[model samples]
Target: MNRILRVKEISELLGLSKSTIWRMRRDGLFPAPLKIGPRAVGWRESDVTDWIKSRDRLQ
Candidate 1:
């Protein structure tokens, strides 16, 4: 099963602020988060990992 990552965890993993992540999502530059709860959102682990790999390729 795929794990869901919260904003704090994603921030730590990507070395980016939570606000930046939100902004990226807003601009469609990052994967859209999944609605885990009525008021909570998270990204899938595989999605994040793939995004990291794509970035690595660009560097």
Candidate 2:
């Protein structure tokens, strides 16, 4: 099963600020969050992992 990650978790995992993550999403450089609730959003673990791998390749 795929795990859902919260903004704090994602921020720590990527070593980026929440604002940066939001900016990346706006720029289409990051994975979009899943709407988990009326006022909540989360990212799929697999999607984040894949994104990290792809970024690693670009370096």
Candidate 3:
């Protein structure tokens, strides 16, 4: 089964600040997070992994 990760977890995994991710989402520079609920947002494990790979290719 696929996993989902909250902002804090994603931040830690990426070694980036939560706010930095939030801003990237706002500016449309990163893969947008999923709206899992009315009051909750998260990133799918696949999506996050894909984003990381895409970024890696750019470097």
Candidate 4:
């Protein structure tokens, strides 16, 4: 099954600050999170992995 990752996990995985992730999301540079709860959000692990792979191709 596909996993969902919280902001902390994504931040640590990408070595980016949570604010930076939020900015990226705002700018459409990152995938938008799914609303997991009234005050919680998460990203699909596959989406993040695919994003990383795409970044690798660009570099």
Candidate 5:
């Protein structure tokens, strides 16, 4: 199963602030997070990795 990364982890991985990540998500510039629980959400590891790869390609 794919790992689900919470906001903190994603922020660290992307070297971005949590708010920045949220803004990117809201602006449709980042991958949408999955609803993992009643009040929690996370992004799929694969999805995040793919987003990184796509960014690399764009550079």
Candidate 6:
């Protein structure tokens, strides 16, 4: 089963603000978030973790 997380969760996990993540989405510089419904969006936990690890590797 896919463990999904919402924007708020991702923001908290990443220690960043929702607006920052949203802005990155708008700029197409962030991993694409999945839309679970017309009114709901989220990221897979694995995807979020991968992104974090990727960022870590860059440092």
Q: Each candidate: how many clashes?
A: 0, 0, 0, 0, 0, 0
In model 1, which regions exceed 4 Å deviation?
none
Q: For each candidate, what is the lDDT?
A: 0.96, 0.96, 0.90, 0.97, 0.97, 0.88
Residue-level lDDT tens digits of model 4 in 1-54: 999999999999999999999999999999989999999999999999999999
Question: Can you write out model 5's per-residue Cα lDDT over 1-59, one digit (the tens) per residue?
Answer: 99999999998998999999999999999999999899999999999999999999999
Predicted structure 3, TM vs. truth: 0.91
Q: Model 3: runs farther than 4 Å from truth?
A: none
lDDT of 4 at 24: 96
lDDT winner between 2 and 5, please give it: 5
What candidate 5 gets wrong by more than 4 Å, as runs, is: none
Q: CA shift at 58, candidate 3, in angstroms? A: 0.4
- What's the true lDDT of residue 15 in model 1? 92
TM, every model:
0.95, 0.96, 0.91, 0.96, 0.97, 0.89
| Model 5 worst lDDT run, 10 consecutive residues | 6-15
lDDT-best of 5 and 6: 5
User: Clash number for model 6?
Assistant: 0
The Cα RMSD in angstroms, rounded to one decimal, for candidate 1 relative to the true structure is: 0.6
Which structure is stronger by lDDT: 3 or 4? 4
What clash pairs does model 3 have?
none
Error of 5 at 42 (Å): 0.3
TM-score of candidate 6 relative to the true fold: 0.89
Judged by lDDT, which candidate is best? 5
Between candidates 1 and 3, the one scoring higher on TM-score is 1
Rank the candidate models, highest lDDT first: 5, 4, 2, 1, 3, 6
Question: Which ten contiguous residues of candidate 6 have the minimum total lDDT?
Answer: 25-34
